[model samples]
Target: MTPTSLNTGVNEKKRSEWLQEVSAHLVESYEVTESGKNPIKRVFFEEQEAPLSILSHVWDEYDTYAEATLHWLYELAEGQNFEVRLKVAETVGQLATYEFLPVLRKILSPWAKSGKPSVQRLAALALAVVAYNEQEHIAQQALNLVDHWSNLKTSSSLQWTAIAAYGGYIGLLVPEKALDNLKIIAQSGNGKLFSDIAKAVEKLFNAGVQIPKLHGLVLNTLREWVDQGENTSVYRLSLLIFRGLMRKSWIVKNDIRQPTLLWLAKESKDFEDPIVYLMRNGLNLGSRRDSILAEILNWLEFVDRHPTLYKTLARIIFTLAASSGNERKRMCYYLKIWSINSQTAIQILNLINKHL
Candidate 1:
């Protein structure tokens, strides 16, 4: 009837049995069930997170066939087919270990633009899935899409897609082209958009990517935290400072981590966020399995020494305690006790109260 309401007259067709062969092979390597009696959902959510290597393997195989499967995935990414789109987004994201960036960038953006919220969310989320692989150009494309959403010329769902993309790309070091734009958005955005902007600020320094006024911005922001805003604003601002400190740790070079950690310990005393903040930082840098574990042990000793940091440290622990799965939960716990939670201040002395 109407342009917006026009529906494609395509018939509902069953998925090709090609998936059967692929799914069977995928199950063996990924140790996952091939049956969609929940398939990808069963693996990503209902089960524990898999190792990066296994996911890498899955990515390899998926990429090998993605071009051939692209048509079906289109059925999933759009075709006005909700479940298909969600799975394509989800499964593809899990194995997002390749250069499918161009395809994702070219093909899916419109789908995210036109699809229903649920479908859009999945499409946007799939865009986010490749973020951790240090895929900057791809990530920038996502940032561009997010920036478009912030224009408010699109649907609110599109805006949320943008927000999630912003947050997802937070793992990326802020690119120069998107830097100022993101700052403008973060400082002024509403709802989850605000959270994303806050994270962009946080990751700008941490990603070890250069931003314009990073050094001055980092120290000044930390100093300014002594001044204030909303509680979240205060926390995020402090977190940006602290995460900046962590990001710059290799350069800080003079027991700076200790003092900064001590300052945060005092400023955010009785708060667990700073602790968790430290842990997440450690985990992100955790490419080596030994490094993460060793880092965990180091933080454990730090936690044990700082009896006063307990209350806030407790928050750090509790927050991550409800992790989405085991590896994430385990890594969160390890970081919490050793680096994130432990690296900061375990002795929750009243830094904020004393200073404020």
Candidate 2:
């Protein structure tokens, strides 16, 4: 039979009652046992997963329950279940609040020094996410972790994961020692560590954190990556990092203009995605819609140098032109200015226009 209509049936009440029962069961099941056995029974994996899953949903619903979720997850991490610890650590990164910094730091301290690579990596990610905003309080902690992991003699996995976790410090009040450690990683050319550094900086940028100091460091590193001969992963990662930095509005476009333009000229055609992708996610530096378009406009002079990029730019303009939105409209208008200046761009626009 078809389901009863919500307005006619008591379905809402029934669902609410079911949810209440489930929440109660989850709490009872997750509570610490008198016998000291992990509250999660290995035989009932789905039942074991329920509490953490519900905790995730609770955190998503509001900030009021975040501390309770953190506390519960910290308790769960004390269990011997590998998956439970890993999942708990992962979830903590998302549900963590600044008020629980001490709890998170305590949970991470021992894992940071774990002998197991798997445990250490998971802990590193947690440490980075939890310390992301409160670098001041954990400045010494992060510094010590970076130094300890960076100097580890044996295991690249542990070292790289540790470095990546510290990536959370992108725009925060990091110590000089931390920056020095990052510089060493950047210059090391260790593929995993280098990529992790890029990922960390990217995450920071995406969080709307800005650090003008990373400009030169990133550019120099990008140049190094370029000279290493077009490793797609590294190239893509470097671009993501560049886009993040540029989005922050602190990277002096003119400083890396020549190198970047030349790189695009030689490599734009091979850049996996078209210029549309690049234009689509332009930085959100200003409150106004047109600000991003203006930022894109500033780069046209450079795009003008390489006719190869003109066609790509024209396609981007055409694709964006059809959409009727404030940002799209502004983008189309500025794109026209660039499209008209170059014959190649104009040709591409005309070709696309004829089909429409």
Candidate 3:
């Protein structure tokens, strides 16, 4: 045998061994202890740190071995270990590139069609990541696959997954298309599906996926949904979706924040639930706490004008204050310095002391 051919065979054997070793380690690392926890609950909530670390190391060390690595991951993905398979699916999406499109589709397609809802959802997310590829054909294939799964005839679980995947990644290539699809979906009046759709919007903002006028486009679409006065389900769902966006409002550009908050405050004037939800959860303000607090303070003025909303708003504030000393101090400081000329404001202030 030729020396070169012998050396090539040796390298192939070594690569195969390495792939097997890494794959086994990943699976072992992710093996969850049977802690008497609900199997489904454990599957979704358990942290698989060791496997994630090993995967990160593998990528750092063997990025050039893309084909072999992807194949090994695919094998693991098809394995019986649910945790490892889920992480592998995520890694496949994370590493998606134009060159890997064929294998990525191969790795994801079966899972996308799996009878298991969890498997389908993970595959949908991986497909969304694939759609982020810059090559139009690669991106289009991923989008089409997800769009196909989103058809009305599909299982509701799979449909929700497809809609979420589309919502999360379509903006990467075509923001306008994403907005249009989302608006249409929102207008469909599928009350249960809106939560998943809202999650997708949250994922988009969390990933910092920028599109010009994203806030305006989203808000306008929501305004239209809310204005369809006959659909109370649509209205409630729209507010819930708006709450999700508002949590991430701190990440939005400064120039856009004020107008967005103003619009939200105006729209929210007649409703109490959204305000209660926000106050209970608190805003994700990062470092812009003061600025967001000021905006929320401005919102409180609307609560002042609407006497019915005052008790609930005040109760939420009282609950928040009672839960944390820092929150209590913060609420007190803001309420004291702000002009509390209105009667509702005074009543809310009076409620704070009762809670303390």
- Best candidate per lDDT, number? 3
Supply candidate 2's per-residue lDDT for 353: 55
lDDT of 1 by residue, 94-152 (tens): 44335555456544655566646565566666766655446676555555555666566
Ranking of models by TM-score = 3, 2, 1
Per-residue lDDT, model 1, residue 277, is 42
User: Higher-TM-score candidate among 1 and 3?
Assistant: 3
lDDT for model 2, on a 0 to 1 scale? Answer: 0.50
Q: Can you give the TM-score per candidate against the true fold?
A: 0.36, 0.36, 0.49
Best by TM-score, which number? Answer: 3
For each candidate, the alpha-carbon lDDT, in order, equals: 0.47, 0.50, 0.57
RMSD (CA, Å), candidate 3 to true, equals 13.3
Worst 10 residues of 1 by lDDT: 24-33
Candidate 1 overall Cα lDDT vs. reference? 0.47
Q: lDDT tens string, model 2, 1-356?
A: 34557556754566446656665422223434566754542323236556556666776677787666555555555544566566666566544443345544555555555555455666665655555645555444544555776666465655665665655542244534444465555555566566567666555433331553443344445544434443444544445555544344332233343323223323444331323333343322232235446544544554566454554455555565554466454544554676766554456446555654
**How does residue 231 of candidate 3 score in lDDT?**
41
Better of 2 and 3 by lDDT: 3
